[model samples]
Target: MTTSIEPGPSRYSFDNDDPESVGRHSHLSNILDPFTFQRLGTLGDLAGKRCLEVGAGGGSVARWFAEQAGPTGDVLATDLNVRHIPLDAGFRVLRHDLVAEPVPDGPWDVIHARLVLLHIPQREAVLARLAESLAPGGALVIEEWATEFGNLCLAAPDDEAAGLIDEYRDTLVNRVLPGRGNDPAWAARVHATMLANGLVGVDTAIDAASWPGGSPGALLIAVNVAQLHDDFIAAGFTEERIQRLYAAVQDPRLVVRSHFTYSTIGRRPGGS
Candidate 1:
């Protein structure tokens, strides 16, 4: 097991109290989480099952797991820097570093990670570790954004604002990512990775959605624009341009289309 943390690209904060982070959390819990649960719910009840939730940001999903597992099952919600989460007897939080160690304890019935592996330098190793942690007949679910420029776009384009948005996006892609030039399309390979790592019944899907003026995605992106204003300035973007794009994101007439979100699910063979 690797005892050292792998250096990676600059990560966007998932801080619990920060407004931007809160907005992003709301976006996930209110919008994306339901969509995810709908898919996983089809797999059947989680009652009495142990779940492992990686990168448990605000712990919304962790809470969901606890509710589904009821009082009988338990969940281990972990992150490097956990802030706020509603907890219960069945749910517990741990400050864990995936790169520095293997899963604390598992043979987990369900392992789910969202937007986590893409930021980690040792993603492949981490995936192997997660695979190993799954119990026979367990399920692993992973989701990541195919986060590239062309993948995300402003639906109601304002040429002027578009230019600024492009500039900010470019800075993130070129200057800010904290990894060793890892593939941006890594999420696209998740299904294959899980299959190769000794999983079966692998399946994959992609989703795209429109963020209308006041939608969670809009709010989240608006937060992102404000959060990274300083970075954009440091990257040679003008304050005026950045401010303009920020305003545009908040405009009710503006529509933003998120990049395609990719998800994969695989199961360990055997009865739980």
Candidate 2:
């Protein structure tokens, strides 16, 4: 089958090349890996299955997949930038663009992408392609951040600090992310999209936990703020305001509920 996948007008908002991104990915892995791994575990034993991990930041989950799939299994990890994914790991690594490049040949048993598709403007199309690439009885697991409930500031030292957190989220989620072609609300639509694409037994599980200041979740917020500092400024956030927001997120007194993580999984039909 041939495809006419074209590059989108904008690329990912975060850059893996930045030195700070190492810490960012680490923080994300620490915060999200447990849930991601648990979701993958639901597929039962993957001893000989072929797995693909897309947009594999820091390669933590890919490494986990390698362990689960074992020596007889095949695991491939791919991303637009693979600087952080080590070649020495027990899996194959590919630096491939999801937009302008052809997807690798696959009748894969499992394909997983975390916090990836929401950043692509042509996500629905890419999703269709991914679904088509699945092997019979294969699973596609997508984990995305949804802003439906917003990033709630549950506790703060004061009302002013709380307001700053809200303002920062407004700028980041509404202005900055969209400016980079991200769809902040895409998570809610994944289920319907999967169903429309003829995937079976689609399920969406939502999870969120409170993040206190100085925790991995809060640190992720700080890392993102630093990485997107310029974009935040371009979004009309003053330097002083940005600084305050950063400090607020680390105040220890501040507690927040991060955006909902929607883990949507589906299976292809007809396999034993």
Candidate 3:
């Protein structure tokens, strides 16, 4: 599929090449895989299905689905940052943009994207495109963050830390990032969005995490700070505050509950 409208640039790009961020995403996928599989399991055997994994960072879920699909089914894993997903059996990866280009022509039996659409300014249009790509009765599962306010609250070991996080989230994170076109609220509206696009049986499950000191989420918080330090500085956050937050994040005693995410599922209306 070829068309040139320019996918353009995202407000923020994941530094996939960075060792810290790469390691963070790898563990991130492991931590979040179960909730996704819970929904996937309900879809029954993928032995003969056609599946698409969009923005398939790390590609763990796509690899699993390809295994389940066995010899009969096929799976395509895609991301703009194309990394080689493990398990080549019945698996393929593509460097594709969900917004600008068409999905592979064959209608999909299941389409899944986690944390993908929220980053897109053209999310609604892409959602429409996803619906169009589905085979009759295909399921689409979208997992995304519901609110960063909950994530913000995790910074509090005390009132002082809480205040710092509140300042950081409100001033630096939310206002600065959204200007580039990421919607942290889109997860909460998945059911409504899917229904409006003529999908049926739309359901949502919200999941939040409590991270221990050595856990993946803890690392992600630190990695995020490293990635966005410039943005924070530009947003007028003090160098001192950034340093404090960075130090606080490394505390071995730290524990925090992250914001919730919705693993929302909807199916195209049609028959087997």
Candidate 4:
């Protein structure tokens, strides 16, 4: 799920308030959270740490942080629409607009955002702000998708299904998403940007896997259909074509490459 925490149609393409967003977050969490947790685990035990989770969609990662922080620590999960975040999870939730409002007062031990900053035109500025908010020696972890490698369809129900996947992929990468201000190229730049923002020991890793139909990866495509069918219709894709794409992703015979996820980690200087 792309966590566009700024509300309104003018700010983002996907709406967290939409019912489909729950599935979107779940499918994405299934596919991505393990890797995310692995990276964060390198920071050592988070007991008594103050953590901030920006653009928390379904709050899976925030809940993890809360569990790690325990009763004495603090975890703040913020999004423009916070309806999906659990209230009893020992963390606080806020109706935050990442693009418009100031960052919460955080000299935080850890700050994390996944599938978020690339959607904001002010991403570079936001990166700097996040770096500055970190407590000395605190870590920042950001994850984003890089789709430039193109979808490789290994198998499909038929030639039409294969072609539909390509067409839909192109339309999403080149048209609809960019029109909503998504920068597909930004993931590749996060490492250097973090370095320039005065963070030390910046590192990044990329993860991708085959997305066979009916798997969580393919479920992501189906969830996208529910979230963006209207956008496809507006982009001159027929209703049948949109639905066919959905069906193709659900067919076990179809296989495609998953989007490459760039996970970048950096730390503020001067802390052990």
RMSD of each: 4.7, 4.2, 3.9, 3.3
TM-score of every prediction relative to native: 0.88, 0.94, 0.88, 0.94
True-structure RMSD for candidate 2: 4.2
Q: Write down the lDDT of every candidate, Cα atoms only.
A: 0.74, 0.86, 0.75, 0.86
List model 2 lDDT by residue over 101-202, tens digit each: 877789999999999999999899999999999999999999999974564899989998888888878888888888788988899999999999999999
Model 4 residue 78 lDDT score = 86
Task: Give, for candidate 3, the lowest lDDT window spanning 10 residues.
Answer: 1-10
Instruction: Show where candidate 1 strays beyond 4 Å.
Output: 1-19, 88-90, 149-151, 178-183
CA displacement after TM-score superposition, residue 98 of candidate 2 (Å): 0.7
Q: Candidate 2 versus the native: TM-score?
A: 0.94
1-272 per-residue lDDT for model 3 (tens digits)? 11222223333355555556577676678678888888789888789789999987777888888888877787888776564344344587776877768887769999999888887899888988898899999998888876556445554466766566567567644766687677878888888999999999998888877775457766676666677677777888888988776665556555667668788889999976
Model 4: residue 8 alpha-carbon error in angstroms = 8.8
lDDT (Cα) of model 1? 0.74
Model 3 clash pairs are none
- TM accuracy, model 4: 0.94
Q: Per-residue lDDT for 161 in model 2?
A: 83
**Per-residue alpha-carbon lDDT of model 1 for 1-272, expressed as tens digits?**
01222223323343444557767777777767866787678668999899988987778788888889977887888777665444443588776777887797988999999888987878888998898899999999998878764635555556765565566567766665543344567889898899889999998888888877677876776676566656567777777776676777777777667767788999898884
